[model samples]
Target: MRFLDPTKIAEVAAKFMELSSPCRLCPRKCMVDRISGQIGYCGAGSLPSHSGILQHFGEEPPLVGIGGAGTIFFTHCNMQCVYCQNFQISRGECGEFVTVEELANEMLKLQLFGASNIEPVSPAHQMHLFLEALSIAARKGLDLPVVYNSSGYDSLEALKLLRGIVHVYLPDLKYADSRMSAKYSDCEDYVEVARPAIREMYDQVGDLELDSNGRAVRGLIIRHLMLPNDISGTVETMYWIRDNLSSTVAISLMAQYSPIYEAWKFPELNRRVRASEYNKVVDLCWDIGLENVFVQELESQDLCIPDFRNEKPFSWD
Candidate 1:
């Protein structure tokens, strides 16, 4: 298996700390002076802000085997999803700032705990910092897959830099329509940015590849959390995937959307997804020639979104 270059990854990490003025690392292009510790829309400075770090089983089956994905919940996010389950941390409501050296320590700590992979949640705004920590871990004999868990609103240029660095790209194509994306996440150009960014991710890692033991060694895993009553324009999203991306890409059609964060404020997402809504989208994925699919049990909703706390980041401890 091909391993990421430890030296190159370390350079990318150190390069982020050298920024003087506003950093435009993410697609938001927020010109915030992160180097001098000025906060931006992401509520983060040059260094990374982590809420928790530990093994998590709330991920997909391949990611959450006996050895769970080593998940480090990065605080703050580029996009503000209306129904975010982890809004507390994503909105900077909770977390402690950690320098690049401290961040490196956290990565190594997870490795010592027998984690299958180092998973960074909501890392779009802190890609540079993540690369630095990854480099340190790589040099320290951390030889597990590095999973880049994101919300899919990434810059194509930034994604290009992550080529060969990220083993599995697990991103949520949240919206197919720009209006819905704007209304929910305040990003009208979500589809525009996400489409090309995902393409680049697929270009780097074509299809989801599993080992003989079924652990994901490499590739892209597209997650489309079927929103309440299929109101997120999932049908169009599936069609776009079939036409744009290769049919071999594995898709996790999730139905564990529980009302959390400020979901009750929006009538469309006030409740859980009905059975018919889940089936409709699942059927569409199959009809459109999407062969590789992973469906979450409807009962998995209660087990998916755990109470956001500072102690643990995932549903499964």
Candidate 2:
């Protein structure tokens, strides 16, 4: 496992904090002065707020070996996806604010719990705080690979800072069309923003590299959740990946889209993904010569939708 030097971590953390005041941590560039308690588009403040930290088995198989991925569910998100499963935290309805030292201890605790990697879910907005905590934890012997789990609406500047710190990049490429992105996530520039950010991630850590036990230590895994009625633009997105990125780039084509949160309000998104829809996307992956693809069973919808209100957000059984 590679860890950033404490000095470099501090430098990156400082730069991120500077970005936070003007609040350009994400593409939104809300400029709300989060340091002064002003809420931005993401609803995140200066301090890092998180809902839970646990050993999560629902992640990709490589991320979850004998010891599960150490997932820290960060509160608030740059995008307000109508069908967000973990809306309790994403909507800023639930979370606990922690200082840099306390957050460092949490990372150390996860390491002690025998986690395969430290996964920070929806971390773009609170990355500075995470880095500060990581610096402290690294010094205290937190030697696990760091997974930069994101919603894919990341800013280039923020992703650039994470070059050395993040070992595995787990990002969701939600939509290929701007119209769908605008209607669903209120981000018309999501495709434009996510593409370059993902490219940068791949440049930083090329392809997925696993250890002797087949546990992912470094690489990029692009997750595309199959939505009902092709709202996610699966075909275009897959082609884009094949043409722009690589056919061999790992893709997790998810079938676990349950109509929760405000998804019921939209007629197009008011149901789970159909078997045909899932099959079409899966078949398309093969058709496009996407060699490294992970497909989920349609029944995973019932098992993967997490309720962050509970102690254990995910239930494997």
Candidate 3:
């Protein structure tokens, strides 16, 4: 469990803060001065805007241990995925802005409430704010492992700033083809950006490492959501992971793709992932000899989809 050195907090915070103004945090590079209240492609400013922070059990098994992952759902996203489950937050329609100190307090609260780890969802755009808050939290006895949960469109420059700061890297390798990504997520270069970003993450943390209690303390966990009509390119993604990265790299194969939000606009994406589709991806993983993989049930859509309007967004069985 390598934690950020408390002394290097200010130096790190400064490096990320510099990137925020020009807004080069993510690969989008919408160079609007966020520090001066200018909004960019992600629709984020200097302050961190978030929907909620709670013990979310709807994650991977290691992430959702007995205590559950302390997930801080940040508002806005670099890419506007058509079938986003948390459309309310990702579209920047709803959320409350919080200062660095307040965010730090929330991290401490999650730790006090017995969370396995501090997981920040969609954190690429708000890396500056998170690092500042995390530094404050670390100074105030917050010792939990930090999970850099992202959409995998992160810039290498921003990821370099998080080398020592982040313990667990949970990123989504959403697409293997650019055409699918451009049509669905509005990111033409998602595969190009995500590949190296994931590689950097794996280089930083290596394979997934679990603690004595089976909770993830450090490592990289790549999430691949199987989409309808093979839009997600599961076979290409699986082979790429095996050939490029190690076969031992952890993978969370999601079968919970529901046609929510703007997915209705696209006929091809307006349905759930079929059992056959899910099975094929799972079988492909085995065929490729990818060792560390976590699979979800095909009927997990209802449990996986979250409603941010409610106080408790997810339903636990």
Candidate 3 Cα errors over 4 Å, as ranges? none
lDDT winner: 3
For candidate 3, write residues 1-317 as lDDT tens digits: 44656667667888999998788988988889999999999888779899999998878989987798999999999998989988999998778999999999999999899999999999999988988998899889888888989999999998987887888999999999999999999999999999999999999999888888999988999999888998999889999999999999999998888999999999999999988888887888898899999998776777777778877778562
lDDT tens readout by residue for model 2, 175-240: 988889999999989989999999999999988999998889999999999888899998999999
Tens digit per residue, CA lDDT, model 1, 210-252:
8877778799999888788566778888888888897788888
- Candidate 2 at residue 290, lDDT? 95
Ranking 1 against 2 by lDDT, winner? 2
Residue 307 displacement (Å), model 2:
1.2
C-alpha lDDT (0 to 100) for residue 89 of candidate 2 = 93
Clashing pairs in 2: none
TM-score of each: 0.94, 0.97, 0.97
The true-versus-predicted C-alpha distance at residue 80 of model 2, in Å, is 0.9
Q: Choose 1 or 3, whichever is better by TM-score.
A: 3
- lDDT against true structure, model 2: 0.89
Off by over 4 Å in 2: none
| lDDT-based ranking | 3, 2, 1
